[model samples]
Target: MELNSDQIKEILPHRYPFLLVDRITACEPGKYADGRKCVSVNEMQFCGHFPQQAVMPGVLVLEALAQTGAVALLTEEENKGKLVFFGGVKQARFRKQIVPGDVIELHTEIIARKGPVGFGKATATVDGKIAVSAELSFAIAEPESRN
Candidate 1:
């Protein structure tokens, strides 16, 4: 199934400036997902990351990858409303500098899952070249409630 930004918002906990994934192009709940982000020069990070030559932060790329995976995990019928958190990031590598106008294609597959903890294989690519790749470890947890 495909999801737009509003649907993505319902599945992901992140918000503006941090909600990296713009849309999900394909997905099989709890198995895999394909998402995308349209990089913009006006994003806040570019202001400080560099004034002369702006580049999307490598860590954020990983976060986007993880969040793409989260959409898959959280979309499972049994997992609705649960929040996903980073347990750790493993074997992460960045091969390209993502910049404004670069449309990142993020792909993620759940590699393992047991109870609340899981691992996903993820990659972010631009123009068919991988910009970043990683094995992401994450946990399903209760969303913090406000009084």
Candidate 2:
């Protein structure tokens, strides 16, 4: 399924300046999803994250990819209303710097699911070349609790 920004908002709790995944191009429940995040110079983070050479932070790239995974995981009836939080990140690598005007294609595939915890591998690509990749784990948390 393709999800626009509004639908993405419905699936994710993040707001502007923080909401990374701009749109979901494809999604398959319990399997994988493809999304895009258009990086712009006007983003709030760009003002301070090195003005001379603004690079999209690697952490936000992971977060963007993870958010795509969260959308895939949370869209299910059983996972709705639950907040997916980062549990762990392993084997993270940044191959290239992502700068303004770059459109990052995020791909995430679920590796395993045990109760409220899930594991997946996510990658960020530009022009079909990998910019960053990581193995990520997430846990579903109640809306009111921080864990």
Q: Which candidate gets the maximum lDDT versus the true structure? A: 1
lDDT of 1 at 22: 95
Tell how far residue 126 is off in model 1, in angstroms.
0.4
The clash count of every prediction, one per candidate, is 0, 0
Which pairs clash (backbone N, Cα, C closer than 3 Å) in model 1? none
TM-score for each candidate, following the candidate numbering: 0.97, 0.95
Error of 1 at 48 (Å): 0.5
Residue 99, candidate 1: alpha-carbon lDDT = 95
> Residues 1-147, candidate 1, lDDT per residue (tens digit)?
999999999889799989999999999999999999999999999999997999999998998998999999999998999999988898999999999999999999998998899899999999999899999988999888888
Top TM-score hit: 1
- Model 1 poorest ten-residue lDDT run: 137-146
